[model samples]
Target: MSGAARAEHRVLIIDDHVLFAESLELALSLEGYDVRRLELPEEGGSMATIRSLALRRNPRTVLLDLDLGRFGDGMNLIAPLAKAGINVVVLTASEEIGRWGGCMRLGARRVLPKSGALQQALATVRRLHQGLPVMSPDELETLLDAWARERRNHDEVRQRLDRLTPRERQVLGSLIEGRTVRMISEDSVVSEATVRTQVKSILNKLEVSSQLAAVGLAHQVGWQQGV
Candidate 1:
């Protein structure tokens, strides 16, 4: 048989719940899907690992959990995978209106809460295979609204960055590129102390905590385009 003929519909599930992953794997297996489960750690899973696994299975769809274990937030992985051309469906129990809306805008085909029935999730898979949009009508509307609002936010972030001095923007650019403070300082002809201060100010102005968060936010806002 050819690859698609011999292969069952492949599925890559990213979740920290071990028993749940096994259960899901077994369930999908019964449905003739080749399922691979990655149980994320308590501190969250690695994007590199998830991406590598996806490339390996090349699943037609992904079942992603918004909460990995304890501190693992799904926000970091959702947009990245979606941007990479993977079809992702967020499987989470979080019903927060904003989060649900945000996930859809970030390229999730569907967002199914764990509290819902397993049959619903399986139904979603069927819809995906049938080339039908997976999310519910309500969810679709929410996603569209969120996408529009997100565009506005991007414009706002751009305006904010435009107000920054050229040096500050340069520092932000280097930071987004994953350069260290020392490296940015050396490359930008600024002292390490000044680089540190600039980074601090940038974070404060952006209202983000870490460099990764800032980088992600910047990417979402189109500030770090072409990266």
Candidate 2:
């Protein structure tokens, strides 16, 4: 490609998989895009690196992945990259359709599953480069429906959580952290019997039949450490 062509079209890939990124870099380069791949760091400071690279390279598009080792989910980068006027296309192996809506809501250009055909993935990127919509009408509708159902489930979980007392909330947190009833009793300065009663109450309030189900509900509602 000519220097002017390279200057106009650049693609950056931020994925932790080195071999996959290198292969994608070669493929895109062969297709006349000035491609660069940054394998995400296993430790801290990836966001700063990404910002610096964006400023220096000024890539027109970024192919991103959600699982970035210890750096955490790459969804957090979507809004910032989009705000900088760079189109982001999520390339992930996650089969959850709700993630597609979440990425698009954060201004991603498209979400392409790694399970899809390589030629189709390349075509999607090329179309996005040309400012075309990647999703067909049926696909868009399916994603929206899945997103709506996810939102509804989230709301219900939050509502159920709100019904728990402060003490119950603390117990729920400990349970979600995989603590045994005896462990929770020791930490809370309560007897094992008291902790068992509290656990039963928690299960009833959370509308779950078992401790495992309650823990799953807690995760669905975005429970975190120290909650």
Give each model's whole-structure lDDT.
Answer: 0.73, 0.80
Task: Write out the backbone clash pairs for model 1.
Answer: none
Error of 1 at 188 (Å): 37
Once model 2 is optimally superposed onto the true structure by TM-score, how far is the C-alpha of residue 212 displaced, in angstroms? 0.5
* Top model number, lDDT: 2
Write candidate 2's Cα lDDT for 113-133 as tens digits: 876535665786688767788
lDDT of candidate 1 over 1-227, digit per residue (tens): 23353146677888777777777778777777677886454454466665666666677778888886554577667777787777788888876656677888777888887986377777877677667877568769976786677667777877656666667778778877889999997897879999888878777777778778777877765675333
Q: How well does candidate 1 score on lDDT at residue 26?
A: 82
TM-score of each: 0.57, 0.87
Which runs in model 1 stand beyond 4 Å of their true positions? 1-7, 39-45, 136-138, 144-227
Q: After superposing candidate 2, which stretches have Cα over 4 Å from the reference?
A: 1-7, 39-43, 46-49
- Backbone clashes for every candidate come to 0, 0
Q: Give the C-alpha lDDT of model 2.
A: 0.80
- Number of the top TM-score candidate: 2
